[model samples]
Target: MAKLFYVLGASGAGKDSIMNMVREQLRDPLMVAHRYITRPVSSGNENHIELSEQEFDFRINRGLFAMHWQANGYRYGISNEVCDWLAQGLDVMVNGSRAYLPTAKARFGDQLQVVWIFVTPEILQQRLQCRGRESAQEIAQRLERAIAYDSVRPADAIVIDNSGSLQSSTEQFLTQMENTVQGQKIKVAMDSPC
Candidate 1:
């Protein structure tokens, strides 16, 4: 069966960056799912549907989204294309908000593997500001929302700390994916004492 690798993180937690790294290292038979969105496409970011609220709701109610969520005033979705890939036994990775995990699990069961990309609030603020997308106030709001969501995590998940160098984080993520894909069980390591 196809493995659904669900990547989760707070806003500005560098989930996109980690996914990009994984993509570069992966070969054929592995792929990333492009999520649909009701927001306008930002240059050089993604392919998405720029629809109005009414149209988004219409399609959503029609059961078009395989999985969907509302975040930062935008509605995002994964389509049947993803389900098709999952049925093909491909390793499909999807980066999404925490709100969609339950629905994904209900649909995919044990085939779903959740990875939480964690970043500190200080790092998140810096990254968000550096991106120059949202205002400082908006970044603060996202941080608040992320904190609330963190408490209710998925039942099965692997936590990837991203507070350090990119190289280390990428390697860690790749190692986890390798183990998961090969059915090699591993335990989470504790942090070193300060």
Candidate 2:
């Protein structure tokens, strides 16, 4: 049996950056599950299967997704096709939603390994602004949403702080993935002080 590594974070928490690095370093025997999103595919980011709202809902109604949720005015989904890969004993990772943890956990059980990537509010604001995808008010709203989602972070998650250098955070994320793939206890110093 393989683990389902669920990567969770705030809107600007750099989940994609870490994941992209992980992909470059770890090729075979690991998979990063791409999402089916209602958002138009952005340049130089995760390649998602983009669909219109109507098409997304049609697929959902057809039971094509293993898990799905709406956030920030977009619908995201992981296709049921991944279940076939899981059964092949391949470790799979997903850029996941915090709101959908309970549902994902129920599906994967002990195979679910939560990796929570976090950043300070100041860093998050700066990153969000740099992305040029949102206005000041929209950025504020995303930060507020982050505060609410933080409370839902799983107790046993391997936490990583992505507030500083991307290289450092990506290395930490790689170690986490390596351990998971080898069935070793994930070793990492907690990013949080509390």
Candidate 3:
């Protein structure tokens, strides 16, 4: 059985970078579900789809997105390719919202492994500043929501503190992922119909 590891974190917790790094290091088959978004392509990031608000709305009506959300006045979503990879027994890495975990778990069953990446508020603020895409007001709002998320429970999750360097955090992520994959296999087996 394969695992669908859904990585969740605050907006600036380095979830995207860590996922990319882990993918490069993984010897196993791994698929990254590219998120569809309405924001312009940020400099140095070229992998995402830059959809217009109208196009995003059309797709949402068409049920094209597996999961979608509106944040910072932009829309974002995960495509059905995520499930496609898991169906083929390949590991999947996705940067998703903790708010979406229940829906994913209900849909994917035990195959969903939610990993929450953690970072200090100070680090997150610095990253957001370095990105230079959001305004000070917007950054403050996002940080508030991030703090709120910290108080909520992420269902069936592994929390990885990422305040350190990327290398150290990647090592911790891989270590936790190894354990998560093994546990996911048991879940798949149990859920399999006799």
Judging by lDDT against the true structure, name the best candidate.
2
Candidate 3 residues 1-194, lDDT tens each? 77778888988888988888998998777888888888888643537888998999998899888778876677888887776666667888887776776777777766777888989999999998998877899899888988998887565678888899999999998988988786665653533210
lDDT for 104 (candidate 1): 76
**Order of the predicted models by TM-score, top scorer first:** 2, 3, 1
TM-score of 1: 0.85
55-96, model 2: which lDDT tens digit per residue?
Answer: 999998999988899988899999886686677666788999
TM-score of each: 0.85, 0.89, 0.89
Q: What is the lDDT of residue 124 in candidate 3?
A: 92
Q: Clashes in candidate 3: how many? A: 0
The candidate with the higher lDDT, 2 or 3, is: 2
Report the Cα lDDT for candidate 3: 0.80
Q: Over 4 Å off in model 1, which ranges?
A: 43-49, 184-194
In candidate 1, what are the lDDT values of residues 1-194, reduced to their tens digit? 45778999987888878888878886656778887777777732554557778877887889877788887788888776777776655668888778877877777776788999988888988988888889878988988977888788765687788999877888898888887777623433222111
